[model samples]
Target chain A: MAIIDLNNVSKSYVSGFLMRKKKAVSNISFKVGNGEILGIIGANGAGKSTIIKMIQGFIRPDKGDILIDNNKPFDPASRIKMGYLPENPYFYTNLTAVELLRFSTSASGMPKQLADKRIKTLLETVDLYPHRKQRLKTYSKGMTQRAGICFALVHDPQVVVLDEPMSGLDPLGRKMVLDLILDLKAQGKTILFCSHILNDVERVCDRVAVMDKGHLRKVFTREDLGNQTMEEVFLHTIEERSEC
Target chain B: MLNKVLSLSILTFLEGVRDRAIFGIGLFALAMMSVTLVVLGFFMRELDKVAVDINLSAISLAGLLVTFFLSINLMAKDIDKRTIYCVMSKPFSRAQYVWGKYIGILFIISTAFAVLTFCSSLTIVIAKMQYTNWFKAFSWIEYFKAVYASFLMFVVLNAFIIFFSSITSSSFLTLLFSICTYIAGQTIEEVVIYLKSANGQEAQLSEFIQKMIDILQYILPNLSVFDLKVQASHAIHLPLDYLLAITGYAAIYSGILMIAASLMFSRRELP
Candidate 1:
């Protein structure tokens, strides 16, 4: 069964009365099988994050439904099987990185004995363990993003959804996050990531889906993105959106 | 599901405590109740009832003011700063988030009320020698009616502020609307009073006022029910029905407002 599936899904936002509702994702349909690293590329406001939101159950689609492991993705049971790292994720600044990780995993239903052990593992997984005791407010952007990813995966979910997970990282931090994604993929975890940074997507994503103005413009593989750099492919898809 | 609600709500409580902004407002409110000593001597003739009324008025004002201000700012800032997306991405539902925030704000407001009420009572007692013996000299019912009801009213006031904040996107608007509701809601009894004047009956003004009163009483909470000071001051027994009615209304009204807020937040697209 597909790990994540969107069938004729649509979402729109009403600005106010008498104004037309802007459709963010319209009749978007796609399926991601288990263990697939699917990278979604889009310009700003291109509905990439909207797909992740629907899958995360953060926002309900106006039409259609999403399935995770052949079950409704938004159900709490499905959420238990998935992990998500939001773009520019924010956390409780008062908590130390370790404390926050412990809290997140506990909230995800990890047993206390197991949660403590996993916290140690995740700290090393994201390379934030060196500064794990420090409060979040003191961390750099890349550090925070790494911690955010740690929180998402603390439960060892089957599918991980990451939106711009490595956007603000330094070269070293970016490389660490990429290596982590590859590691998670190797562990048989499916990943759906959205980013404008095509190089990282090209390096890690086994498959690629380009979205534009709420439409699924194209879906291809590494070879397709390789036919031209992801930047060239992304620019071409964006231009196609503008033309339509 | 209840655990989800409770866990998320606890975060709201902790977040409210960590906000640091509420501390300043809370201290200021405490000082306001302390300063009511001067306010008491000025109204000393009626002493107890007037003191209870004005002091509760101060507490209701502060609790409503802060709850309305804080809830909106907290929710909006979290979203603006993108902290909420991370939290929401967990197994937490949006409604759970809203309810959790409301619960946290309520905890803060409730604690603030306890502190302010103690200060207000102390202020009232220290103002005059006659006031110190005031409670014991009378039926214990007076203080229970006056002071206990005052605290209860503060709870209702928090409910009002929180409910308003849940629906209104802007904190300022929520604060303004809540204040208007508090002030205008209090004045409704007087409007109803004028309706029964029988003197205003000749002018046909009584019917209009009555109609206005009915509409407002239905739409806005009857804050007067929570004001037991008048009965206390007169040493009249407070009807248990009044307090029960106020609490019942608070539960129903706050629930409606929260439901409305959850509906709004569920549709909100986090930026």
Candidate 2:
């Protein structure tokens, strides 16, 4: 069974006094199977994050259905096995990195001893252990991103969703995050990530989902790569969808 | 659910404490309290009244600053910064978020009041020592009661802030709405009393004006009910039933506001 599923989900946002309606995601549908690493690739404003939001139950779909663990996204139980890291995530600046991790782990119902142990390990893994005592406000952008990653994974969720996880990271940080994603994949965890970096997606994703102008243009597997790279396929699909 | 709410509440409280505005307001309140020393000297026979009035007003003004600056900023920051996306993605409902934030702001306000009231009480004590004979009628119990009521009033005001934060997209608009609520809430009872007296005297209240006052009395909080400062300052005996009734009023009104905030926030979409 798919751990994350969206069947014809659509969302529109109204703006301004005139209530001008803008379609954000249109009839978007996909499924992330257990232990599958799926990457969503899109340009800016291509509705990648919107799909993640729906899967995480942050927003309701205007039409169609969304299911996590075979339950509606609106159900808290449906999110029991899910973890999410938003783009450029900001945490409570007053909290140390460890404190934020503790909060996250506790929210997931981890007992004190177990949560503390996991927090120690995760901070070490992300190379933030040395600075975990410092408030999040004092951390650099890359450090904050790493903390956000730790926050998402602290609960040891079976399905992880990350939006633009590599956007603000340096070369080394990007490499570290990519290795972490690969590590999670090896652990048999299902991962769904949104990114603009085609190479990183190709490296870690079992399948790639392309979005263009709020529409799912194509879903490509490793076998479908053939001689064409993800960038080429991505551009072609977007151009084809635009022409249509 | 309780765990989530508690965690969020703790985080919110910590964040509020770290904010420079709280420190700034704390200092501002202390400075205002010190001014009572100078202001008290200006009055001869009513030194106790001046001290009580200044001290209570300082606490009230401090509460306003925390509500308008710290509490509003906390709620609005989460949304405007999109940090709420991280929070909302957890196993929490919108109502949980609202309750957690409201409780956290209450904690900040309560702590601020505790400290300020302590300082204010000390000020009153120092003044009492200087004029031992004149402060014969002063009651510490009454003064504390006034502070408690003032705290309850701010609790209701913070609820209004939460409701506004849930509905409005911009913090500025939330601030504006909350301030307007505060202004209207503070004066609506007085307006109602005036209109009623005018009606009794046949002094002519327009039907529209009378209707507006009636609507405002119900819509806006009757904050004046919480003003026990005059009674405290004068050492008047306050009925126990009145204090209990106002406490109940604060709880029910805040509860309703929270429910409304949760409902509105749940329906809201994040950008």
Best by lDDT: 2
Model 2 chain A: which ten-residue window has the lowest total lDDT?
A73-82
Question: Model 1, DockQ value?
Answer: 0.44
Which stretches of model 1 miss by more than 4 angstroms?
A15-18, A21-23, A62-64, A92-103, A124-140, A223-228, A235-244, B36-57, B76-82, B118-141, B144-151, B154-168, B198-219, B231-236, B259-271
lDDT of 1 by residue, B53-128 (tens): 5665666666655666665556655665667776776666667777776776677666676777677666666654
Off by over 4 Å in 2: B199-219
TM-scores for the candidates: 0.83, 0.96
> Every model's DockQ, to 2 decimals?
0.44, 0.71
Model 2 residue A38 CA deviation (Å) reads 0.6
After the best TM-score superposition of candidate 1, give how far the Cα of residue B195 lies from its true spot, in angstroms: 3.2
Distance from true position, residue A71, model 1, in Å? 3.6
Task: Write model 1 residue lDDT over A1-244, tens digit each, in one string.
Answer: 5889999999998787888898999999999998999999888998998889888876788899789887675456777778889887788786688777765665677788998888888898778789988878899988888888888898888999999987788898888888999998889899998888888999999899989889999999887655588888888877877887
Model 2's CAPRI class is medium
